[model samples]
Structure formats: structure tokens, C-alpha cells
Target: MRSVFVTGTDTGVGKTVVAGGLAGGLASMGYSVGVMKPVATGGILINGEITSSDLLFLQAAIGNTALDEKALSMPYCLKTPAAPAIA
Candidate 1:
């Protein structure tokens, strides 16, 4: 099994685009792909549940929704603007 990890030194650096493109491309080639966005900060709070926008975008971009969108995300969520480490 092969895996790819997408990251950046800062936010808004096209990490999602790059990662999603790779996953989508691999899926188009008939490869089974799964995405796990381990950590995400500044998630939107809806109905008292913290959610990651990145995870949602990735799910749609890779055309993967095998599991619930919230299931693929980390258990803990932060609402800070900084990265998970900094926040």
C-alpha cells in the first residue's frame, strides 16, 4: 500500500489542492484511496459540534465518502486560527 501526506509550512498554501488532485488522479486510475485529515484547527462550530472544513473539501475533491465525514476527522478540534500545533 502506498500513501501520500500533504502539508505546508503555512496556511492557504494550496495543500488541499495538491493533495486532492493526487488522490483524485489516483482514484481515476482505479486505485482505492482513503483520506484522513489528522488535525485541523479553526473548524466551524455547528450545533455544538466542531467540524473541519478541510476534511469536507477533501472528501468531495477525492470523491471519497465511504465513512461519515465526521468520522474521518480527528477526535479533538480547535477553533484557533493557527495550526494545530501552534493552537
Candidate 2:
């Protein structure tokens, strides 16, 4: 199996777009794709659970809920909207 890691020098970059696009494209080509945000800040609480918008977006791009495992997709979600180092 192959894996791709996307990162940016700062926030507000096209990391999500690029990563999602890649995942979507691969899935469209009938390849098994898995997306993991690993760590995310600025998460919102929904039903007393921390939700990561990035993970949701990736899930949508993949066109499936197979990546719905919050514990695995977003292992470290912080409520504060700041960098992990600070949050």
C-alpha cells in the first residue's frame, strides 16, 4: 500500500483541497483510499463529540463514510482554534 502526506507552511493553504482532490481522484479510479487528519484544531462539538471539518470534507471527497472513525481519522482534536503546539 502507498500513502501520501500533505502539509503546508501555514494554515489557510490548499492542503485540504489538494489532499481531498487526490483522495477523490484515487477513489474514482477504483482505488482504495483512506484519509486521516491525525491531528486537528478548531474542532466543533456535535452531540458532545469533537468533529473535525477537515475529516468531514475528506469523507465527502472520498464519497463514503468508511472514514467515519473519528478516533482514527482525527486522533487528536482540540477545541481551540489554534496550532497544536499552542492548543
Candidate 3:
């Protein structure tokens, strides 16, 4: 199994876009792909739950319905837009 980790020095970069693209591309090629955010700063309310858009994008990219397992993908999802420590 291969893994890809995307990181950026700051927020609002193309990390999510690039990661999602890679995951989507790999899945299209018939590869089994799993995506994780681990920690997220900002979130939006989805069905009464605060959800990370980046996680949702990654989940959609891999064509999986694992949103119910958000704890696995994004263990730390903060509603605040500040840094993880401050948020």
C-alpha cells in the first residue's frame, strides 16, 4: 500500500485540492485509496454536526461513504479558524 501526505506552510493553500486530485486520480485507476485529515481548523455545520470541508472533499474524491467515521479521518476538527493549539 502506498500513501501520500500533503502539507503546507500556511492555510488556504492548495493542499486540499492537490490531495483530493491525487486521491481521485488514483481511485479512477482502480486503486484502493484512503484519505485522512487528522486535524482540521475550520468547519461547517452539516446535519447538526460540525464537519470539515476538506475531509468532505477527500471523502468524495475517494468515492467512499465513510463520513460516519469522521473520527478516523479527522480526529481533531475545530470550529474555530485559528491554529489547532489556540482553537
**Which prediction has the highest TM-score against the true structure?**
2
Q: What would the C-alpha RMSD of candidate 1 be, to one decimal place? A: 2.3
Tell me the lDDT of model 3 at 63: 94
lDDT of 1 by residue, 41-65 (tens): 8888866777777776777766864
Q: Tens digits of per-residue lDDT for model 3 on 11-59?
A: 7788999999999999999999899998888788888988899899999
Q: Model 2 Cα displacement at 44 (Å)?
A: 1.0
Off by over 4 Å in 2: 66-68
lDDT of 2 by residue, 39-82 (tens): 88999887788888888999889886653477878899888899
Candidate 1: which stretches are off by over 4 Å? 46-48, 65-69
* Per-residue lDDT value at 58 in model 1: 73
**Candidate 1 weakest ten by summed lDDT:** 65-74
How big is the positional error of residue 62 in model 3, measured in Å on the Cα after superposition?
A: 1.3
Local distance difference test scores for all models = 0.74, 0.86, 0.87
Candidate number with greatest lDDT = 3
RMSD each, Å: 2.3, 1.6, 1.5
Give residue 9's error in model 1 in angstroms: 1.6
